[model samples]
Target: MKKLSMLLLASALALSLAACGQGKQTGGVKEPAQAQQGDTGKAPQATSKKTTYPLTLKDSSGKEFTFAKAPERIVSLSPTETEVLFAIGLGDKIVGVSDLDDYPAEAKSKPKMGNLQGNPEAIIAANPDIVFAGLSLNKNSVTKLNELKLNLFQTNPKTIDEAIDRVLLLGVITDKQDQAEQVAGQMKKEKQQVVDALKGLKPEQKKKVYIEFSPGWTVGKGEYLDDMIAIAGGVNVASDLQGWKQISEEKVIQANPDVIFFAKGVPNLEKTIRERSGWDKIAAIQGGKVVGLDDNLMSRPGPRITKALVDMAKALYPELVK
Candidate 1:
């Protein structure tokens, strides 16, 4: 009986020890290393919050807009911004575009949101993160967009410097600063080359160029085209007037421009000025210096402006093809 009781006591002690070991294996004991973390399955917390900035942008019409964050899905409501977007390598992010954005070939593929003034509904439907426009964009529409909580960036570039600055600004907004700088640098180089090419040409060697736009409207002094004409090594014969204005037919004859550039938008324009009324007497008509050019290229302040300069050079100075 005593031996049996002693054996039973030994078995009870072994079972008790086994139970303690199993408890330890099941993680019942506190571990200092494991207690360092607040929770086992929780992910590591972030050190800081993401940084954001409030940006204020002014459009051509002197309107200002503020944004809390950078816009991703941009809707281009102006042809200028569309061209700028493509120039700065943000073309892929364009969610919507205006009907006027015909350059870069890819613009045609983007969803059309109608004209700038009447396309707010389409814009809202597209749900773009931002809208890019020019001075011509309607204030009411802009207000509506704002009410819908869409960010708007309005750009109006009057001079070449402004144009370059606008491109860089767009690049910054789209997070493509390096690409914008490269494009701006290339354009600046091309412009310098144009200026350099015209170094020695005398005023007499330069053609008297007339850039005619509608029936009576023509680009005068203090316009983008005038700057391009001077840059492209041609003297704008109509530089006497300020801005785009109407002038008499007799005045065109009096100026006697050696070359007349008919921008594509002119009404009733034809090969022969003789066919038109009150224009045959002009010196350009007599000398056959009328040249048709794509107005979009000349008017737009995008990367293609350099190409327009080259085209003008080709037209004005055909002899120096070497």
Candidate 2:
């Protein structure tokens, strides 16, 4: 009986030690299944609290403005500015646009303020966070907007390079810097491609080009169209003049350009050019080398100017580009 009790005691002690070992295993090392359900799982991701506002930027006129937050309701007083805003993914933020804005098809539906002379009352009624204007905005209108403590940014891009820079600046102000950089970079790349394609042209290979916006209105040395013509491997015959001005029919006849480009929006433009009294004598008319292009692409300093350059190059040198 004593030997049997001693054996039972020994068995009990071994069982107790086994239980303690199992307990330690359960408490110290978790099973794979338990790990997936507990502290080993991913922690909740923290949200970014970076602020893009209290932003200050200088406009083309060297005037500075500050924004407390990203502009939610932007009023674009210039059609070019309207295009720029839309191109950089800020179309949904636009509250108002100028009367002349028609590109991207959506801008046409936006509330239209007056062109050149913007309606201050209408602009104020829109409750815009910011306003983008051109030099056409009269001094009185600017004063009224100022009196109301409204933010008005003037966009005056004199060259294609400046226009691209403006896109980047707008991106910074609107909290879409990445999108804007992509747009500006693509534009620069496309423009440089065109430049590279035409860089090897000899002086003799360059064609004399004439562009007529209206009946008598032609682009001159300082204008974007003139620059486009030169970049597209053509020489603007009216480069002697500066800015948008009328060239006498006599001078146009003397220039006798190899190609003629007319603004596409003008009514009966091709017919008007063909029926002009002495135009039949012009080389372009004789060779039927007249092409029509979108006036906005040539006029507006926006992202689409690269498209305009491609169109102009194709029109001027069909064999080379194709």
TM-score of each: 0.74, 0.80
Relative to the unseen true structure, what is the C-alpha lDDT of residue 101 in candidate 1, on a scale of 0 to 100? 71
Best by lDDT: 2
Residues 1-322 of candidate 1 have per-residue lDDT tens digits of 2221111111100011122221211111122233334658676553321223464444444445455655768898766678878887888789898776787899999999886553877888888887877654556877887787777655554455456666666665556666777877887877777677777888777777887655555767766678778877788878889966777777777787877887555445644444656677677777776887776766676666667777777778766411
Candidate 2 lDDT tens digits, 1-322: 2221111111100011122221211111112222234476775553322225565545544566666777899998777778788988998999888776787899999998766457888888899989888754668988888898888877655456666777776776777766777888988887787787777778999889998877777878865667778888999999999876778988888999999998777788789888888989999999989999886776676887878888888888877764
lDDT of 1 at 300: 71
Which segments of candidate 1 are over 4 A away from where they belong?
1-57, 65-67, 138-149, 264-268, 272-274, 320-322
- Tell me how far the alpha carbon of residue 254 in candidate 1 is from the true structure, in angstroms, after superposition: 2.1
lDDT of 1: 0.64
- Give the runs in model 2 whose Cα sits over 4 Å from its true position: 1-53
